[model samples]
Target: MEGFDFEKIEKWWVARVKDFFIGKPFKIKMDLSKSVRTLVRGVLSQAERRQKDAGGTAYVGAVMQHLVGAKLELFLDEALEHNGFSVADAPTKRNGDFQIENVVIHVTQTPTESLIQKCVDNLSSNLSPLIVTSHKGAISAENLADAENIADRIDVLEIEQFIATNILEISRFARESRKVTVEQLVEKYNAIIAAHETDPSLSLIIG
Candidate 1:
């Protein structure tokens, strides 16, 4: 007990009790920046809303699209420099959410017949079609691709898997942890949106 500071310990405990009733001081080593946190929180909020009411599916879907689009853009910029290709948000009228060279990437929370058809259309137009959807949607999407006889021509990818793969690649290239790399990419995304107004095709309107 000679080395112990009993009074300091008591004060700390009292402060903790008060904080429990009111609020703790703002102090956190953020894993993500403010803008990125807001974007992620918005997506999570939409997901929660969807859980409460299936009617929020459309809203959640849109948020997922934007989130995926933004992340893909950052990944492409970092990964494609030596590949002679670049990724960008597709126009509203396009069949894909993103375009990379001759490849068209369609991002969805879930795959549907309509999405499959859009991929087929991309193939018909001589563009390589890549479908990025949730892991739960991958199998069904691939089945739809096979049914349409486009499985050989199109690539179906799981969103989480794709992100993991790219994150590893980025971490390797930067010699950093995957989590840190993700935070860096998000910071880059924030800078991009700040420099140029947030690309409408890559941003969601959550009201």
Candidate 2:
């Protein structure tokens, strides 16, 4: 009993909890006929379903965040720094989730008033704030920006289109190339999840 390794047991228990929180990699079918935005939404919808199944432990935010990170890495042709899902911007002193050039990108499933304030803060620092969220969250972000009197300064976009448009451009607007583009994105997304997240279930699988 004196040599009991409580810390090791605690780590093992936490890992098990995270595994249950995100049960499996959601399977998404790739179809050339489907618009890239539609495909992206399908992925997010699967994340939503998994979250609900987990009794609302909230993994959608992480899914969206990492997807955005993956897309940016591929589209921008550079590696971006990745942080774990639960890490807050304030603690990390990050301008946003990802920053490139003068643009500060914030990815979230739910847009809050605090986020609006962060956008304002970014503006004061002469950096453009781009908010990437779900379609409904985009509306909420816009409304929040208006309430804070910074609607024009902050750009709010749905993550589906944000990721989709880049994929189209990266694939050179060709249909066949789009599939390859998506496959690359999935691979990058899975790699990011492996490196930055403890939950392997957050990894996505393509069918």
Candidate 3:
């Protein structure tokens, strides 16, 4: 520690993230009785509790972002470009969280007026803007869009429902296949977390 340079260590870490190896795969065990949205919210609630315990520094948004990325990759059967949470934190002048074709997808824990403004910008560019957030955030996003007189232009989706509905559709509504679908989701999410986040605590366990 005395001899090592901090700047060199930081540089090494930056390189390490790109080559990070994913270890044992984590699987999501589905609760058959509960709706997919409910299960997804439960996972997020646990993440929120963990965030509160860790001095209240925000990681839930990171979790949501990566989860969305993982879901998209699994659903589309192709990888999506993933950036570290730090890059996501500094979103000034950025178009949206992720862009695919003509759609600009924004993922956030709490939707803000600034985010709505970005959606408006996306519209001006002839791109469809989609806001994916928590159920409460969905309402707030819609309200913000209304204030900007663009409520009908943008699409607002609850994160839980977005992922849950996808899972159901992917599994073809079969109870047995749902567990496997959820497992794939978790596996992809963990891979994204490992490659993008320095903190291993951000990784989701199979439980």
Candidate 4:
């Protein structure tokens, strides 16, 4: 996959081995960053039971950053990679994200023109992508218009939505393969991705 999470390589995040997930996506992100900033300040964020300063201090820049970082690391990394999708940013995966065959993911908190143009260029170059945004609020009119203009440029799927949508398959594959953990499933899939990506001739063993 093109959008190999930089963490995937850095932290030995071979998917299932050391991977972690709470019942909620926000919590997972908070755990990864060790901050509850997003929970306090986000449009729909709520503090976990453990955070003492998580209240009344929400809506600060740190909060948004909390949301962005968590959303990117927890949900974005897990969901996209599980599907063997590539991100634009790999090795230095933050620059873009993953590339799965034709699909790519560009993680962001807001959809900027520079980002959109990059997506356009990538798409024209034959990379299908989705924009992962940390903006939990409804789409702005401006964003809506731009999104329409380049709807085909790249997709934009929220991090939370993606996890809820795919956790089932994650669970299913884990059970089927006797991996017994999300980390294991992720490991299997990512290995499959690297193998097929590096040598299409090795496709037979991937399944």
Candidate 5:
């Protein structure tokens, strides 16, 4: 049947749907200790599974971005605010996935030439540019920036490395038992999203 594996794909979707439904109805408080444990487990599990499937790199990349974004929103926002900074989700028309103060973070599964150009555009607009891509894509991103003669102006970081640096406790707990439930993780994530909804600092208005 050519490159098709209907049965395997079906099973994958079924498992994902089941997990979604099973984890949908529960709620928990925003306990950073417990939530970080759950987030680490979930991100690793999802990344491992995605990396093994066809076109898995793209899937893993998207998942990594979401996970990273969640961590930034839930855990790092307070610290940013404390330091007189804030992060906001960038709109599609924006150059990056997130705006952290005057810096724009462009997250990609792979750092293609187009994405690099976007970073350059951000730089021209007087916004600092940060590229976050898969570990394998980090080198390419850096090279592209160099080619564009903007390497010194932009920063490239591997997604995993960023997580490790910003969420050291979670990285350490990734090896431990899964003490937190998926339901709790979802609740914590939702809390972060809800908080952002009314956060004036997160607002991005463009004329």
Candidate 6:
């Protein structure tokens, strides 16, 4: 007679499921962070206000497009995978953006994560989330340690490291993304040169 070993059965079952998905492709699920959504709204509102004051046109669609960095998030997942880390892409409609096996990864550019907590149960949630930012730099370890429910599981990723790690690949991306000619760059240089006339520090950037 065979012994009723529940732990053995569970391990075998889990192994089989994991094995089934080996080498299988995963999709990028839509897991947009709440903080990102709020920041978008704030920026759009500010833009609208500026436009209204200047008597210019306000386009909501354009604001939405700028806020959603779908491409950046996709690239992040690619980088993580390229480094031998299995990444579960963001879900299409889920509030939590992604899952790396059991761990969750949330992408955002906002400095605050309060809003993100509103969309999902962070503490009770089984998966952890990491905030990815392109602008916000040098996050405090304490602040990172304070994320609600996800404090223990949540962390932040800086864009500088992200770009630095994938600089070689990003060079190719930049080449593919070119839409303007040398003329455009020349004009930009001219403008920068004029700006530098008043402030020497403006010369910090050069082609």
Give Cα-based local distance difference scores for all models: 0.58, 0.90, 0.81, 0.41, 0.57, 0.37
lDDT of 1 by residue, 1-207 (tens): 899999999988976765453221111133333333343554445454543444332534554454465567667665321110123334336657667889887877678898888887888888999887776789999898899998899898766566656766766744346557666655554444334443332223222
What RMSD value applies to candidate 1? Answer: 13.0
lDDT of 5 at 114: 85
For each candidate in turn, the TM-score is: 0.59, 0.88, 0.82, 0.41, 0.56, 0.33
Per-residue alpha-carbon lDDT of candidate 2 for residues 33-71, written as tens digits (9 for 90 to 100): 888888888888888877876678678899899999999
- Flag the better candidate by lDDT, 1 or 2: 2
Say which prediction, candidate 3 or candidate 5, comes out ahead on TM-score.
3
| Prediction 2 global C-alpha lDDT | 0.90
lDDT of 6: 0.37
Q: Please provide, for model 6 over 13-96, each residue's C-alpha lDDT reduced to its tens digit, 9 standing for 90 to 100.
A: 976765443312211122233222332334345444433543453322222222222233334433222110112223333434
Q: lDDT rank, highest first?
A: 2, 3, 1, 5, 4, 6
Is candidate 5 or 6 superior in TM-score?
5
Model 4, 91-148: lDDT tens digits are: 5434355555576655544556777666766767877767655545215323753764
Q: Runs in model 3 with CA error above 4 Å? A: 1-29, 89-94
The alpha-carbon lDDT assigned to residue 51 of candidate 3 equals 66
TM-score of 2: 0.88
lDDT per residue as tens, model 5, 1-207: 799899999998987875554333222233455544354444545545545543333434444555456657545544222111123233336657777888988777678898888887898899999987766788999888899999999988876667545554544455333233323234444444345433222211111
Q: Report the lDDT tens digits of candidate 3 across residue range 1-207.
A: 799899999988865653343222223436788788877887787677666645565767888888899999988999888887668524555578788889989999999988888888899999999999988899899999999999999999989888988999999999889878988888898889889888776777666
Candidate 6 clashing pairs? 29-90, 29-91, 30-90, 30-91, 30-92, 31-97, 123-149
Sorted by TM-score (best first), the order is 2, 3, 1, 5, 4, 6
Top candidate, metric TM-score: 2
Candidate that beats the other on lDDT, 3 or 6, i.e. the better one: 3
Question: What residue pairs are clashing in model 1?
Answer: none
- Candidate 2 or 4, higher TM-score? 2
Query: Which ranges in model 4 have alpha carbons more than 4 Å from their true place?
Result: 1-95, 135-148, 173-207
Best by lDDT: 2
